[model samples]
Target: MSRVAPLAPPWSKQDADGINRWGHPDRTYEPLLLVRCLQRHPALTAKLRALGEALYVDATLPPRLRTIAILRICALLECAYEWGGQAAFWGPIAGVSEAECDALVTGADVGWSAEERTLISAVDELEATGSWTEQTWTALGGNLTDEQRMELLIAVGWYRTICTLCNGMDLPVEGWMRPWPG
Candidate 1:
């Protein structure tokens, strides 16, 4: 993972009216997730950061549902870094136990809730064939609140975009960049 000098103005902790890098991992002096995150256009950076916070923190959607969607997305994309990042959340935040995460690791054993099954099946159908089946939508019971719906779509799109960037950039997985020989 070779480091590149910034091609544009770097946001200081002084940026964002004082929120600093912790509030914005992309604004950190170094790239936190994807190398492209460091070089992303300012507008996209803000949107991605907002989506990151929404996906991980806001809980506008049920954490379990959001995490499950992310897991399925990461698996679909074969984005190992994204999967590693998303998988770490199965316990502390999503209330999903290690046993469930283990089962999902194989996919053949997803043993999901009725709602979780509907969401994952929809995501899979959409990813594979570019749309959800009518039956899949019918099974999408009214479990998600309205706010959850908005954030969930945005969150899915957000990570999918990042997955594209990270893979296209050939960004090393986080630990692969550590103890940098360069």
Candidate 2:
């Protein structure tokens, strides 16, 4: 395992409550690891984070594709918390299979649609290579709406950052989750 970063402060009820009630994340809540996310710039962090969730998870992307992109980001970042948190579909919007999800983690394709396969492969390549191939953009760009394209494009960075935060904090995936591939 990689060395863990120093712990930040735990998020308090006040912080949690704010996030829970107001739907605004209090980045400062987790201090033990000194992520100091809150201190950096609340407005900036909040907007960025909100944009991330709004575009990637809550937006119109199919649940399967959304989860695939997210899980792929988790795999790339090796973040159990983010990967594990989305474990049970969290109600509706639950899509995809255990095998498919695992395939994402291992950089393998398990016979998804051309679009599905392309998106996952693109995300993987982006994570591994830092640049996307023209073919990826072409295949995806044609099939996706402008809105979806922008959302997915932004999601690459969004989930990437969120996963890093979870990994840095050593946050585990929710209890019910089974290491993705299981």
Candidate 3:
């Protein structure tokens, strides 16, 4: 059970707005547990949701790279709620293979291309040290524009914040979401 239960409907206008504005199409109202829990703090929900939209919708980082970073971050944090939801929904849409998702969870060696390898390594480094090494930054530069690099860093921090929320709240994976891959 979640430490803080998700707020159910008859939502305040503010929460309804936040839900309408920020809810992920796949996750929302399949009970919307996370966003509804967040609606407990409406102001923060709005801001966080907006940031999420910026990262997922408006950012320059490619969707595939962003999804990879999210998977790695959630795996490292052991946040099953976020990891499962993303793996089930966004991962395939972003072309992240099941093998790749399993590799993320188990740290298995996979035949990822050079760019994919660098992105995984970068997420690992960030999880370990909270910043990328110069070598990793240089490697990223080959494939990512400056804006993309910045967005990647922000995505890392943003997803970490999300994982913290999911894990700390003891939020259950939605019934529709894939469970954590072995």
TM-score of each: 0.70, 0.71, 0.93
Q: Write the per-residue lDDT of candidate 3 for residues 82-173, one digit (tens) a residue.
A: 98888888888899988888788998887888999999999999889989888999999999988999999999899999999999999999
Which window of ten consecutive residues has the lowest lDDT sum in model 1? 173-182
Indicate whether candidate 1 or candidate 3 has the larger lDDT.
3
Clashes of each: 0, 8, 0
Q: Tens digit of lDDT per residue, candidate 2, span 1-182?
A: 22343323464654443333222243222222212333234455555545755763378766667777887888778776567554444212456777776776776657888888888788888888877777877787877876776677677777787777667656644445546553
Ranking by TM-score: 3, 2, 1
Lowest summed lDDT across 10 adjacent residues in model 2 is found at 26-35
TM-score of 1: 0.70
Tell how far residue 164 is off in model 2, in angstroms: 0.9
What candidate 3 gets wrong by more than 4 Å, as runs, is 26-31
The lDDT per prediction is 0.59, 0.62, 0.86
Question: Candidate 2, which segments miss by more than 4 Å at Cα?
Answer: 1-14, 21-45, 56-58, 90-92, 107-109
Pairs of residues at least 3 apart in sequence or in different chains that clash in candidate 1: none
Worst 10 residues of 3 by lDDT: 22-31
CA shift of 103, model 3, Å: 1.4
